[model samples]
Target chain A: MKHQFGDRRRLLQLSIAAIGFASASLALFIFMVTGTALIVVWVGVPVVVETVVKVRWLAELHRRRVGELLGEPIESPYLRRTEGNLLDQVRGLLRDPATWRDTVWLIANGTLGLALACVAVCEAVLDLLFWWLPPGLAMRAYARLSRALLAPSEKSRLALRVEQLTESRAETVDTQAAELRRIERDLHDGAQARLVALGMNLALAEDELARNPGAAKALLSEAREASSNALAELRDLVRGIHPPVLADRGLVGAVQALSLVGPVPVEVHSDLIGRLPAPVESAAYFAVAEGLANAIKHSGAHHMSITLSLENDLLSMVVRDDGTGGADPSRGTGLRGIARRLSAFDGALEVSSPPGGPTELAMVLPCASSLPKTLPSYGTA
Target chain B: MRVVLAEDLALLRDGLIRLLEANDCEVVEAVDNGPSLLRALTTHRPDIAVVDVRLPPTFTDEGLRAAIEARAQVKGLPVLVLSQYVEQLYARELLADRSGGVGYLLKDRVFNVAQFIDAVRQVAAGGTAMDPEVVAQLLTRRSGDKPLASLTPREREVLEAMAEGRSNAAIATRMFVTEKAVSKHTNSIFSKLDLPPSEDDNRRVLAVLAYLNG
Candidate 1:
């Protein structure tokens, strides 16, 4: 009873949301029935579609509020709603398991959500002030019930995880293919062209040698320069393919070198003790670099901080910048690239950036690191 | 011209030495890695340092870093960075020093002996020589602001030529136009890019490049 009122603010907020959920579910049920009955008329289609979407929205809100009250997160196991024309989106929604799950939640949340809200208020008022009866049993029960009913079933949750893995794998392949094409294009426009020009220069030099020594020498030197340019282009292409520094110095060193070279000042702190797997290190390096690059280019930020830690067998990074915020992962390829790279490592990235100021990007990767073979070292650079 | 060379490959280093020697430029020292290159640069304090972008002992940007560090230690240290490719990012770093004695040229540019020599000489004499490829990259980067987009194609080409540290006469010769016409296009480029007008080619190149870089 005493514990129920300890977090009174959350109880009250959730009570209101529960009430909202109950009312919204009732309205949804009515709309659903009316639309079904009037299905013969084409007007019912849009109403039914809108009802489904709203039902999901309400359930999502209820889930969040309940989860907050419980002091843990309850994930919505909904697949992303497809974006398309109305009819297509309607058809897509109809076929979605989450849509049906949400509809069921809507019906249940209507009655149970209302009862839970009323019980919470009654129990709190009766017990907190008067100590007439123990409070919060109903509210606690409702919170647990919401987690049970609103969240995805184990099977569906696994299915969604598999689907996400498949999609990310496909993206990884596509990103690789796109990268290869870019390299190919770069080579075509850069070294290949220079080599061809060099060949022509050499051919001219050989022919002109008999007639004009000075001009022939000039052409010969030109040929040499062209060959040098071709070599330089190839070197750059190889560097782009794999930064040699990453191979030499490991992630920490590579990232430090990157920040040192960046236009903006970047501070790095690390509790990461040892080298990570090569692939993970590469992905993390690139992700950090991209974050830093975006801040330098668009954020107009004066200062940036990167923190790396390996605790509880989890490698986590927080990239924070004092800049014009509003970074949307969906808006640009940079953040999306970071997310995709992280997905491969079973890592996660969270971005919180409001319009007025500082942007914070937090990335968590489930990884384990071994102690360095040579020595134990630690620092904040 | 006295120069120090930093390249990872022995074959290429020897070839570069031969090429420079043929052009009346002395290669005071030729080292294959970063530390030696830096040591040579400081020891010789030559008229110029021709450095590769990649070198031994952590080859990624080794020579570029050496160049930057060298310039930091010795102001206006003339460095003609030779790379297989050129990036605007690298160009920006090279030109970060306002007192210009910088050049970044693609290795293929070395094939055009006269132009390559001209770039080396230009850098040696405290001028800027940026790669045309890098210049193109800078020019083609789409800016939301209409300033760059506002230029006519002709003016953009002139601007590219100018960014490569070309004089009005050289731009005219390349475009097969009168120097006066090139001058007019440059004026348009300068105004369109919102830069103060100038006859000094290196200063104009730096201004236009710094803007394009942004």
Candidate 2:
């Protein structure tokens, strides 16, 4: 029932657009033939403006419909160029593709709209003129003709919209699936494979323990080293997915935990006293973790500090390291991931790592409305 | 010696139990999570407890918390925490109580079975066995401290070795210096840090640990 109603509404919209286009074109034709510059200046400009506005409105409608149907977030930024002078504004409008496309669509719509109007009028006239015959038969024939004329065009337009939406969704899903596969491949090839090899080494070492004590000892030592390496790799892989500490203790605890492990001295100050929404906490935790990792790996200086606070309902974190600086977002995937994570939360990441000292990484995330009121107590336990 | 073992992984737990048992220590209780670990300490009253920093059901600092709680409850009951990562935070938390019987080492240390066992023994005997990594982190953090800067490079090494609870002889051996020279460095470190010259090794260790742990 809802679907039928939506179809009917679309049909009404198409009919209105057809009528508006026909009227605008006829007015333009009349002004052109009479060579009335004043009429052209007044009527032509309004008609052109109205047509452009209508097309833009339709485009926005289409975009919103696609978002709703596909259940995905798609942002289209409409560039609104404003200039100080009228001449500059006019130049900007002329350069805009939206304006040109709208003009072209309007000209095409004008021709089709006139043809549609003529058919509608002719059908009505025939029905009235044939009133002397059986009224029901004549009316039914006219209705059939109108339906045949409109069905194909309406169906084509509907199909075009659906096709565009489907193509966009397919692209999104494909990208997401590809990312998942990449992560799975990384784990399987990197850590899981290493662990399997280590296990086999352990088995071989066990068999040779008594028969070849000297060789067995060496094999045992190799197996031990392999196992340790594999364990470290597995830990890294797990951390990439979700650090267990972050999930268990929330963002503050997670950052504190990271500070404890780093080679440099770290001081942590947090005002996020309570548990935040899981996704927000996760992003914040990883952002800080990545920052700390970068500081430790690249920075030569020793002291590091992390601060988390809620400012004006937004969760903000700043990680600073007093080290030889020059950290760049473009140089590493870690900082890029941090940017992406913050963006997902409608947040922003700002980095300031000038040469010769103190690198600072800052991130802000919109706080989830469902955060707990009080901070959870944290200690060794 | 009776010991309680707290580790999440079944295979590692079993292996550690077997190893400790072979070393003539009785494994009185084996618990996989933090709460159970604390409960086991109360019930078993083991002479020592070996814990993993990560434990079941959230796996972040649960074992560390349990170890701290257990120490508070049972006076002089030694605790050793093994962690996959070297975290200066955990080290500081362990040393916060100003106790002499705590140990924190990276889990990788387990591969060197003899040294790991020796550390456990040291902790059980009411002496600290801190990881070199933890000491390094502490020193790095304390680089800004005036007292730390006052020490010469050799004196810094002596202080670090002292913070690890090494004897003057061990420090000399490690640094390849004469024991007399190690003694001189220790005296210089003590004087620079304004610590009273104490004859007792344990007292000297406690004083140094207090300064480093700060």
TM-score to true structure, per model: 0.55, 0.62
TM-score of candidate 2 restricted to chain B? Answer: 0.86
Best by lDDT: 1
> Model 1, which residues run further than 4 Å from truth?
A1-48, A83-91, A106-132, A166-174, A259-274, A298-307, A318-362, A366-381, B1-214
DockQ of each: 0.09, 0.27
Residues A1-381, model 2: lDDT tens digits = 556445444434444443554566555444333432433455544344344445555445533543443345333323354455544554555555445544443444356546665554444445345544322232233223323332224334554455555655565466458878977998788767877877787788788887888887887788788777776776666677777667566888778877765567789998777777666777688778887887888888678899999977799999898998898998877788677666655677898999997889988888766445333333332
Assess each prediction's global lDDT (C-alpha) against the native: 0.78, 0.69
Q: Candidate 1: how many backbone clashes?
A: 12
